[model samples]
Structure formats: C-alpha cells, structure tokens
Target: MGTKKYRRDTLIEAGLLFSLFYLPGYLFLAGIPDPRSFNSLLYNLQIWILLVPQIFMVIYLMHRDDLLDFQSFGLVRPGAKDIPFILLAAAGTAAVVMAVQVTIMLVAGEVLPEEPLWKLTKYSMIAPVFISSLLTGYSEELFFRSYLYTRLEVLDTEKWSRLIFVNILFAAGHLYEGVPGGFNAFILGCYFSFLFTRKKNIHIPAILHGLYNFSALLLTLFL
Candidate 1:
C-alpha cells in the first residue's frame, strides 16, 4: 500500500511540474496579469502571485520527499575547469538570441512583446526583471533538467530517447511563444540536456540557462 501511494504521489508531482511551467500563461490569456494595468502596484503584485506559489510547492515537495539534493538537483559548485564552459554558454546564448531574432523575423515578421521592450531596463522593471529571471532560471532548471532529468534517467528507455522526449515537453511548454519561439526553446532544451549530462553538474547549465534567458528577454524585447 505504501508503494502504491508513493507511485501515485510521484505521478501527481510530475503533473504539477508540467502545470507549473504553463500556468503563468493562463494569466495573460485570461487577462488576469493585465498588461494595461502593469504600472499599478496591484497589477505587479498579481504577476508575482501567479508565478511563485506553484514553484515553491515543487521545491517543498521535492525536499520533503528527499528526492532532491544539491548534487542530484545540480546545485553543485563548479570547479575552476567549469568556468570556460559556463562562459561559453553565456556567449552561445547571445548567438541564440540572434538566431531567434532572425527566426522571428522570418516566421512571425514581428512578434511584439506584451510589455514594452524599450522599458525592460527601466528602473521600475529592474526588480521585476531580476526577480523573474532568478525565479525562472533557478526553478525551471531545477524542475526540468535536474529533477525530471534525474527521474527519467532511471527509466529503462535508451538515453537519447529519454532526453529527446523531455526536450519536446520543455519546448512545448513555451508553445505560447509561437513556432519560432518553440523551435528556439526546443533547440535550447536539447543543448542544455546535453550539457547537464556531460558535465554532471547543473550549475553550469543553470548559469547558462539563467544568462541565456535574461539576455534573450532583453534582445528579444529590444533588438
């Protein structure tokens, strides 16, 4: 009975991770995180409310169940040798931004951001940008590449097959981004998966993922 309960709980937690990734979009679709009201503190607070709780739940459950740890979760501190790889990831992210820009131009012609791109670096947005980037970087990497990756590794499936399957879900989570964005995310997902496995340290991927995302937001919004 305990075994059955454990399996059931695991299944539910898996579903939660997928849901958490996609839930923030509902706010925009439902017009709850209304862009029109973004200047108001209340509107801004709504954004945080929508984003935070589910993520915290994932962390709490993972910790409580003893399913996560610094190493298993890819929270290891990097060795000096890892510096170049991390830096390379940052540089590669810039290239990815350029590629995505070209792809967006070709596919969508002009995919306007919900928020003003020009205002991304504004003083008011500094806090939001930092908070959102930090949350996205830390949470998504921990949930997807770290937790999901570790669980999937235990499956009898072939290695590449498992990685590809996970990448598809990761890309699909960003489906609201349109075809180009999804494609970009798919490629990025695959790359990060490869990095995570090869390095056996999620810190590099986390750093790379965070910087990639933060830069992608800026370049996508501005350039």
Candidate 2:
C-alpha cells in the first residue's frame, strides 16, 4: 500500500512539473502573428522572462522531494574536460537535424519548410536572440531532459520508451513553429537525450542546445 501511494505521488509530481514547464507555450501560441518575425522572437523572450518565478518554484519542489542533486542536474562548476563533450553534442544535434530533413526528402519527396522554423527580420533582434537561446538551452534541458527523464526512470520505464515519450512531447512543444520545426525538434531532442544519458551531465547538453539555437539564429541573419 505504501509502494502504491509512493508511485502515485511520483506520477503526480512528474505531471505537475511537465504542465508547469509547458503550459505557457500552449497558452501563448495564439499570440504570435508571425512566428518568423522580430516580434515573435521578442514574444518568446518575454515568455521565458515571465517563467522565471515558475522555474524557481519547480526547482524548489524538485529539491524538496530529493529527486535530484547538483551532480544529477550537472550544476557543478565545469573544467576544460567538459568543453569537448559540449561541442560534440552541439555538432551531433546539427547532424541529426540534417539527417532527418534528408530522410524526409528522400522518403516523402517533400521538403521541410525552414523559413517558418527560423528567421529574424531585423539586425537589432540579435541581442534578444542570444538571450532567448541562452534561456532555452538551460530551461528546456532542465525540464525535458533532466527532470522528466529522472522521473521516468523512477517510474521504472523502459529506456527506449522513456526516450521516445520525452522526445515526442519535446517535439510537440515546438509544433507552434510548424511541422518542420517539430520534426527537427524531435530529432534533436533525441540527440540531446542521448548526450545527457551518456555523460550524466545536463550542463553539456544545455550548452549544446544553446549553441544550436544561436547557430540557427545566425544562419537566418546572414544567409
């Protein structure tokens, strides 16, 4: 009976965490008139800014439950050894994203639309883009990769099942950017999951995720 109650509590906590992290995205999707425009970028930044308090609350709850530690979440101070893994994770993300696009093109004969997925209408938007990338890198990884994955492990979920389950939601969360964006996000989500699992370091994956976003924004700016 105690075991049953514990499992129920775990499930409840995980669900609450998930909703807390993602509910705003769903609620605010309707507000962006053009997803590629400068205004859209600012809107995303605002969402992250507003989420600061909620993020702190979520962290506090996770700590209170003793669900994670500094090492578990890769919150420790880094050394030079960590740099290579960070770069590799970022490169792996790019490779996976490209591979997915190529596979879709070859199999379905339809090109995934890129314009709607990333664009910046003005040069002045660069600073906000960087800020958005930084926030996205750490925040999303905290929720999607570290917290959700840890909870699933506690639930005794199968490894592959956990990967697929988390990435599906990760992808779904990006559906506001359109189907292509969601598809890319799904693939990259899988890559980042693998990185975190192998390295036992969320910080590396977070930095990699940030680099990828920053690169995408730069590509839109120059190319």
Output the number of the TM-score-best candidate: 2
Where is the poorest 10-residue window by lDDT in model 1? 30-39
TM-score of each: 0.71, 0.84
Q: Model 2: runs farther than 4 Å from truth?
A: 1-3, 27-33, 36-45
* Model 2 TM-score (2 dp): 0.84
Q: lDDT tens digits, residues 132-207, model 1?
A: 6666666667677877776666433478887888888777666665666677788888788888887778777767
Q: Which clashing pairs does model 1 show?
A: none
Q: For residues 49-122, could you state the per-residue lDDT of candidate 2 as single tens digits?
A: 76566557656666765545656654567679998867766677777878988977886686656344557767
Compute the lDDT of residue 67 as modeled in candidate 1.
Answer: 42
